[model samples]
Target chain A: MAIHALIFDVFGTLLDWHGGVAREASRLLAPVRPDIDGGAFARAWRDRYQPAMEPVRRGERAWTDLDTLHAEGLDGVLAQFGVEGLTPEIKRELVLAWHRLDAWPEVPAALTRLRGGFLLAPCSNAHVRLAIAHARRNALPWDAILGAEFARDYKPKPAVYLRAAEALGLPPGEVMMVAAHTSDLVAAAGCGLATAHIARPDENGPGTGEAAPAAPVDVAASDLADLARRLGC
Target chain B: MAIHALIFDVFGTLLDWHGGVAREASRLLAPVRPDIDGGAFARAWRDRYQPAMEPVRRGERAWTDLDTLHAEGLDGVLAQFGVEGLTPEIKRELVLAWHRLDAWPEVPAALTRLRGGFLLAPCSNAHVRLAIAHARRNALPWDAILGAEFARDYKPKPAVYLRAAEALGLPPGEVMMVAAHTSDLVAAAGCGLATAHIARPDENGPGTGEAAPAAPVDVAASDLADLARRLGC
Candidate 1:
């Protein structure tokens, strides 16, 4: 495939959301709710992420950005962990934890190399605001910020893949969806976009995420740097 | 107003489209049709630009990117100049002149410095593909591609300004709209976004564009670097 652009799954593929959210959740919540587990709070928040986007993806609700959806789901997640006593200011800071996510080590420089040959963007569920904040904090030299907000829907949906390629003025076949998730890669491949699997074995937690592609892909590598080398960047 | 992001106008503000388009059009057409003036031809194409987006801005036409509009406008421009003999491939390449346009000499480094302090993006009428291609060619350090396609309309439209602010997850007052044209900054100011005027004195031709704001703006400077320094970047 003649890939002209690489659209990434940012959360797991580029940024370590689980680790970031877990750390921040524990750091803030531990002072208030000493009995709560930071890892469990992070997982609870992430668990609600899909369900929050479900209504919008299915058109049951209007297009809502990640921060808004995250804020809307925060109370329920807090209750699930029996956490309390956090002020709205603290809660806002906690939601912004997603925006403060760090890239996997080797990602910044690797993406810089890959960018030499391909238009790089995150075709993630993250909204433009979160994406920009996250990219700036992590030093991602993306040629564009794209995906869900541009599509007005969430991932695993064909529109997300199609809209991103359209935004890049590329045919689906000329764009490659790079993700650590097998389901995400499969979804993109089904939409006729090329797929690259970047193994993020610790994305969910240690040894919890994909260690390798579970399906066919145009490129597969152990991490972002390896993926960059494989792509001849 | 606290400015968290700076959105820009592309054609005359960031890139020297007047010169670039003139050079390409003259280089290509001058060989076969020596009678046509490159300067006038470039002016003719640019004159058609506003008229082309007028229908869309007035809601008389569906959303269409600049590439399509430029391509459509090409035939009339060629006929206006009585030019002929360009192959389809040559014509396509000519249309891509917009993507290959270079930044004004001070723009690249000025934008790099500006990007250090605020989120930077093109709030131009140009679509994502056009923006990405142009930015890559010029080494523009944009955090995201915002504007037309994102708002589904051309600039000077309130949606173009407001939607761009929305995309950056900031209130209108927290974003600065940067452009050489007074009309663009005025439009942005009307939308409650802060405005910066960077004098592109030769944007239309030698000393043809604005040397200063025709109306009030939040920041007014001689050029982008001057503007950056004024903004403390």
Candidate 2:
């Protein structure tokens, strides 16, 4: 069967998470802690993301959605920065910052083009609610939301990729995983799906890293627009 | 919180399944069984739909998506009508007719309006792939595909409605269930979700049955456009 669907890695692939999170943090924390470096705070919070999910992935902890994990991680980041006295409601609003990330400049148009020829969805580690909020905010034209909640596990766990493919009623070979990260593409390829890499050098910060795939991939593009053109969409 | 999401019952509510299936049957069966009444044949196949799901719902059989159930039902309908000798490839093509359904005339515009104000998805009995195909063909703007596959069970089952709400991280009362079927609304209400009814008088053929709510609902409208207007969208 030919490739009929394209599942994307959401965080750094479609949206500019670093800028969005840092902006939200600045806006939210400015009133209480004007001296805090919002960008540093955002990075510190995100740095814990992988470790937060490890327990669930290892089956040492029961399944929990990313929203809850983000909330827990936010508390530790706040304490690490010596910030305190925030009300529960304020903390809750801040933790939902992930849902408000803005899409990269080329995303909406690229998605609209690719959608003409293939099914599109987010195969991210984010929970369903987070995915829905991001799509609504960014006008992402996804056919469906497939992620951690649907599979009850995070990505790079083979179950996540397999479940997404199964949900589309396609063999792994008939689906392509499109991402900026090599590890995500590698895991997807290991599950028999095709892989495409789109670079996002600023995903971590300028000059800190290049979003090139560490391993060879089937296709490499400068961005989603280039990917769309390469795919002949 | 106010209702933040609206989950729709797709088959009769958004898409004209009756007309779509009847037309596809007429086109596909014309060469093989010219004497068969396509509309009646379509209804016969649909009539077996509920019965086919009973075993899975009852746990007597393992979970199977609607596509497989529909295929099995197609076989029985073919036998009942004395139609035979369809090649496996032809049968597969015929089974996919469900994915090609056209939306009721008002659906796309109304959904566009609704999508502006609320998160939207299909809480249908269809499988995930079937739902995605229907959305693409009909231009229905679903935020996510939540149906049988998500719950691993068919609708009218409390788990289906509850799980759909849970996946969105919203309490039952914060999600509204919109449908043309009274049974579906009733089940959703039982799960503590608000219900809205949209009349689809021709769902079972004009004048044969009215798609009125069997019990009181939060709101009622003649069509999706009317529903969107009533919701202040």
Candidate 3:
């Protein structure tokens, strides 16, 4: 069957959420902590994000929307950074910054090119608003955005991929999941979707080995531009 | 509370499915039947579309997908055109062509711009494949794509819109339904969604008088770009 669509993993694939989140956090914190290192603050803020969500992701707690997760994460970051007396309003702003992260350099052009042939979509963990805001901010041309919120769970859950394909109205086989994280691809692949890995050298540190493992990928490229070419779109 | 997202009706709003279908049918018929006006055949094909889908849309029939509706419409179009010797494969090709129609000129840029301010999505009658294909063909940047296949009913139905908001993890009021057709927006409005009208000149035709009527619209604009500006995005 023809590869009718390419569904992306958004968090680290199209946009660098970690860097963006930190930068926005730092900017918001600048007015309050004139002497605070925004860079370090941003990083610390991001560090708390996942750990905060782990309970929900692991189902130890009931599913929480990212907004709630972000709020909790922000509070911990403020405490850890020794930034005192941060109001709930300011914390909310900091949490919302996740919606304004910048797109990766390769994103806009690669998405445009791929849109020429395949239906370019995203199967992301970001909530619907967050995902849409990120796409609009970066001008990433997505045909349709799919989020974990759509499935009521985060990825590497099979429901996310299966629901995405069902929403796209294509059975599992015709949809290809393009992701930087191998685990996400493995999950999509488990649902019978073809998988493509777009390598991100900057992600997960030099030795993190967080990229999806090699065997699961139907196609792998160094960047989105190369990914587009490899897909022959 | 602010309306954070706008979900659109695709067929007549962003893309002129009727116009495209008519154009393609005419082009296809030109060489073989020089005397036969293909435009009339195209209109005839589209004319049959909604009427045939009425039973399903009205809940008289068990829920059906667009592909089946298109097939039934195709059968009527062939008979009206008096075209003989149509094979099953040729009919299938024509039915699938509905998935590939071109979007309006203002669509891509308008959506790209509006997408900046709100979570822009599609609440469409088309299946996911058709929706994604139309977006790819036209570069329509959607945050999420919701199709009738997901709810198993066509537009003007509350269940479809309700299911969409539920999947979005949102309250119906926070999600706006944007469309050129007033009926879809009216239905969405009844479902407690904020409604916006992106008035397309081409969408205002004789048959559409039935679809467009005065309704309490939350926002009305000439197109998505105008909608974005008015929304202060």
Per-model TM-score of chain B: 0.97, 0.97, 0.89
Worst 10 residues of 3 chain B by lDDT: B204-213
Model 3 Cα lDDT, one tens digit per residue, A61-133: 8767778887777767778877888777788788777787887897898899998887666788787667767
Tell me which residue pairs clash in candidate 3. A168-B128, A182-A212
Candidate 1 DockQ vs. native: 0.89
Tens-place lDDT per residue, model 1, A105-204, is: 9999999999889988999999998998888898898888889998889999999999899999999999999999999999999999999999988887
Candidate 1 chain B: minimum summed lDDT over ten consecutive residues — where?
Answer: B28-37
In model 3, the runs with Cα more than 4 Å from the true position are: A29-64, A76-84, A167-171, A204-206, A209-216, B1-6, B26-64, B76-85, B100-120, B138-153, B162-176, B196-233
Chain A agreement with the truth for model 1, given as TM-score: 0.97
- Clashes per model (N, Cα, C within 3 A): 0, 0, 2
For model 2 the local lDDT of residue B117 reads 82
In order of appearance, the predictions have TM-scores of 0.97, 0.97, 0.77
Candidate 1: segments with Cα more than 4 A from true spot: none
On residues A1-233, what C-alpha lDDT tens digit does candidate 2 reach at each position?
37899999999899988888888888899899988887798899999999999999999988899889989999999999999998898788888888889999999999999999888889999988899889888989988888688888998999999889999899999899999999999999999999999999888688554567789899999999999999999
